[model samples]
Target chain A: MQYITSLITATAKPPPDNAAVFSRWFVNHSSWGVLMTVDGQGFPFGNVISSSDGGTGIPYFYLSTLYDPTGMNALKNSKSCFTLSETALGTCGQADPQFPKCAKIALSGDVLRELVSVEEDSKEAAFAEAALFANHPQLSGWPKGHNFTVFKLRLKNIFLVNKLAPARYVPIDDYFKAI
Target chain B: MQYITSLITATAKPPPDNAAVFSRWFVNHSSWGVLMTVDGQGFPFGNVISSSDGGTGIPYFYLSTLYDPTGMNALKNSKSCFTLSETALGTCGQADPQFPKCAKIALSGDVLRELVSVEEDSKEAAFAEAALFANHPQLSGWPKGHNFTVFKLRLKNIFLVNKLAPARYVPIDDYFKAI
Candidate 1:
């Protein structure tokens, strides 16, 4: 399976419009991001993972609730944060990663499990399954015993810095609309 | 001032060696990473930041105690985690970001204050300043009042995944030696 992935790169400098459109563009085009959750000691633990689709502005994961610490952390405390860097896509030019223009965003929200046993619709599950498989075909063939279930972070707040100083907080409603 | 940066892409795969060399390479070549700390609510908060030359295998940052929450969190509880991804470098080709072969590393350590007032860094301070400026020359010109002082993470544990399951743990000594 072919995976087409790239960070924001150097050319596409979305104007700093404070529009949810740029946030949506950054989130959807990127292939993977770091997921953070509170650990047993109450410390933040972050892990790199692939999302099913950023186009929808919601990130999907194939997680084993019993396998990864992130899952365990989520089960213990649903409050979590997801972060992505436009520099990771390699578009920041000579700018430092922290350079406001390099573009960094953190979405604070709750990560909830969506399984066939708990969800209302079988069709939504199937659609999600197909999306996950299409984006990460290899995940579809992983060991069945891993018991990987799908999870998504429903975002509540967005903190973004795309240029210069002073980061912007994107409202949840505006973010979805822009996407 | 021009910068030429690209995620680790199109290069021949490293020899499936889950060695410290590969991990060090990924860290040094990547310009920025996500730094995580415990928030007031005990949730892990992550922000993207520029790291000085990773060639030494130790990431140094210029942060403002009055500005970034990462600095505030560090002052409260010195422990933190720094993460970098080959995917950020645009490498890994078609592999998903979570793929073991794509290389993701989390360096768990303590964030230390390195100002001349805090420690007697006689020579070490100068070396660090030069390294930081060489890799991130733009940072040197920022307003001094932002109080962006240099800080470095004293690595305690290395969680690296370069090829497959069972992430490798590179000892601090081993990591430095490889660097």
Candidate 2:
């Protein structure tokens, strides 16, 4: 796991109560997390996927329908959620992963696939490529035949649990506004 | 994350194709992972939870409905999945988290809550208590008022992705039979 965090940029953790800034920092520093999607049977399926924020609070993904159940499931039903634990970032210290102070966040939203042709030179494609490759360099080398596509979460609810109290729902506007 | 692995027992890695041995070794050494459940809105929700097998290869959990959305969601709809990534074990090295060789697993089943009265000297209660607390000692100190219950996945499917090929479905019997 130390190797996993070597790529995480050094970012000071904001106070636990500061949902907007904390959430932004969390996503920015996290490169991978569980992406939950409703399966064809309607059961929740959690899949490990690489992600990057590209300094934006929103998470972007590089997925291939040919190999990923998550991507296939998302195409059928966009309802999805992405979750990250401080455990993954190696910052939870000795706290139990589920411990509130260990910090966890769930970004609930629909997975919107971008129709970007990287070979055709579109700004959207450029942004998507940079967002993913900058953080997940391996993704850039995946077989092109896998038809990996860029997807982003159309966030509707941001759930942050970082303290002893109940989880807080950061206003969606505040999430985007955070530096 | 080095501290996180300190608690993991020194279990030798089973070969990639040995799904049963590998899955068991993976789960036995791992203490926590994402537990996915269908939320009230029928969306998939993944929550981080502590787990243990007590060397039985059957995963067990200590969950409190009063504090865990995963526990509450299980009560409403038993359909669920538990996912673990080798990345958490510090065994994946530099492979992308989604890399097949990094080894990930998902156990899909219904979460069956066990009715155990530890105070009443039930063997089931004793097993459940030891299963979780043995791996997650902090769980024993959690507030008793949280009304934590023991739950187990009634495993129907064992999905393992440990190679370049498509993920494999390990027969349920093989999983339980693995040492």
Question: Per-residue lDDT of B58-113 in model 1, one digit per residue for the tens?
Answer: 78787777777778788888768888888877778887888777888888888777
Candidates in order have lDDT scores of 0.73, 0.81
Highest TM-score scorer: 2
Using all chains and alpha carbons, the TM-scores for the candidates as numbered come to 0.85, 0.90
Instruction: In model 2, state the lDDT of residue A113.
Output: 82
For candidate 2, write residues B80-132 as lDDT tens digits: 99989899999898998988889888888898787555544255556767768
- Over the stretch A1-179, how does candidate 2's per-residue lDDT look in tens digits? 01122333237877877788888889988888889888888778888888986775768888888778888999999999998989999988899997888988888999878765544435555676777887778788888888788888889988889989988889999987776
Q: For all candidates in order, state the fraction of native interface contacts they contain.
A: 0.62, 0.67
User: How many residue pairs clash in all the candidates, one count each?
Assistant: 12, 0
Candidate 1 lDDT, A1-179, residue by residue in tens: 12123422223546778558788778766667888877666567778877755245677777777667777778888888888988766677877777777888988889877756644634455555667777788778776676677788878888888878777889888877663
Which residue pairs in model 2 clash with each other? none
Please give the lDDT score at residue B68 for candidate 2: 77
Q: Could you say which candidate leads in lDDT?
A: 2
